[model samples]
Target: MTGCQGELVGQEVSLYIEDNEGNVIKDEIVTTQDNGFIDLWLPRDHLYRVTIKQGDLSAESEISTFEGDNTCITDMQLL
Candidate 1:
């Protein structure tokens, strides 16, 4: 996540993708590096509840990717 001046370097980030039933379909936990960036590969063509957490801050959103397509999510700036 980016901060006021620049990217929040070397921070812990957690990502969780859950199904409709609230069961975790894919879980990814990693530390951000080189301009607060992390990469994750998730299953395609399915609805998922995406949860992102860092420290006491967090955010959630729903998304579905096209089959066999890779997605990139930008503009996650931490206030």
Candidate 2:
């Protein structure tokens, strides 16, 4: 839901999210939907660190949910 801006339909990946202060938010395994996306609800007005993993490949990015910030984040690339 937060990274890998490409078609990865039905792929299962590990998700790890944390606040800027190092508070853990989400850490679990999730599957991508048919649209190559996942659904997540995050608190507003804070910056977060997002990491996604699929096997040995992984991606990481920084995201925010503040007002006027982009909600749909899809720019991380799995390496």
Candidate 3:
């Protein structure tokens, strides 16, 4: 993911995967590197939401659903 050079440096981000019943299946926390980048691996046939928290700034991506048997990547920015 790419963002304004001054927007996402040294931030705390989190990824969460949940099922249709809203049960949390997986969760991960990551710190944005110098490039404000994060790499994620997700399981197939699951629904997920990614939340990014940077100090008092926070943002959450839309709930996404995965189809095929493959991994996916997502990028989020905290406003």
Candidate 4:
């Protein structure tokens, strides 16, 4: 990890989709840009698991998608 103040820049984040039966339906890997943000387009109408790891610290969340679902911000902790 880049020691740029423990920022999550250029970090690989995984956005995954699993079926009700725990089968992976779709998976995506996104890297944060210089602005410490990832611009991605995810399919709507599905449930997803998003995960990101910076150094030994990590973050994960479960999200439910719907039509017109555009953006999601779970936490804000970066310079």
Candidate 5:
């Protein structure tokens, strides 16, 4: 599995993980580090969607499906 990260300096972004039934399982407000990056972890046997927002700039990652313990990294660029 592969995931992505977003880059936003001194800005607050929201992260959410949803199940296949469109129910929110986890959500949080994350601030990017000095490098403008954040790490995320998702559970197995579930589908997830990730979104990053900073001010008027926001981007969403494609729906990702996980089946086992694995690590995925993705990068989102705020426009």
Candidate 6:
């Protein structure tokens, strides 16, 4: 959430998430918390593609909920 850390807190963004199998998990607007972060709870042991957009900026990344995957995702960036 690099480009989203400070003033972007409480901002609403479009969130789109889908599983590797092409199942849509989430497709809606979400607000960042006080910490300028959005938390998503998905099923475990699966791979997912996530996209977040705020106005003209957007970020997309692949994530996994496997056992050894890092819970804290900090790589997705809005540019």
Clashes of each: 0, 0, 0, 0, 8, 0
Question: lDDT by residue for model 3 over 1-79, one digit each (tens)?
Answer: 7454434566766655565667776676777768656656555566665565655777776454456533433344567
Model 4 residue 16 CA deviation (Å) reads 5.3
Once fitted onto the true fold, the runs of candidate 5 whose alpha carbons sit more than 4 angstroms away are 1-7, 63-70
Instruction: Give per-residue CA lDDT, model 6, range 1-79, as digits (tens).
Output: 3444644688999999999999999999999899788889989999999999998999999999999999888778788
Model 5 superposed RMSD (Cα)? 4.7
TM-score of each: 0.69, 0.88, 0.56, 0.55, 0.65, 0.89
Reference-based lDDT, residue 73, model 4: 59
Sorting all predicted structures by lDDT, with the top scorer first, yields 6, 2, 1, 5, 4, 3
For residues 1-79, what per-residue lDDT tens digits would candidate 4 score against the true structure?
5423335666876655564458776576767878677654556777766555545655666666676664655363421
> What does candidate 2's lDDT look like per residue over 1-79, in tens digits?
4445458889999999999999999999999998788888899999999999998999999999999999777677779
Better of 2 and 4 by TM-score: 2
For candidate 5, report its TM-score: 0.65
- lDDT score, candidate 1, position 74: 58
* Residue 68 alpha-carbon offset, candidate 4, angstroms: 6.3
Ordering by TM-score = 6, 2, 1, 5, 3, 4
Candidate 6 residue pairs in backbone clash: none
List candidate 1 stretches off by more than 4 Å.
1-6, 67-70
Q: Worst lDDT window (10 residues) for model 6?
A: 1-10
Against the reference, the lDDT scores of all candidates come to 0.70, 0.89, 0.59, 0.60, 0.65, 0.90
| Best prediction by TM-score | 6
Model 3 misses residue 37 by how many Å? 1.2
Global Cα lDDT for candidate 3: 0.59
lDDT of 6: 0.90
TM-score, cand. 6 vs. native: 0.89
Q: What is the lDDT for 53 in model 6?
A: 95
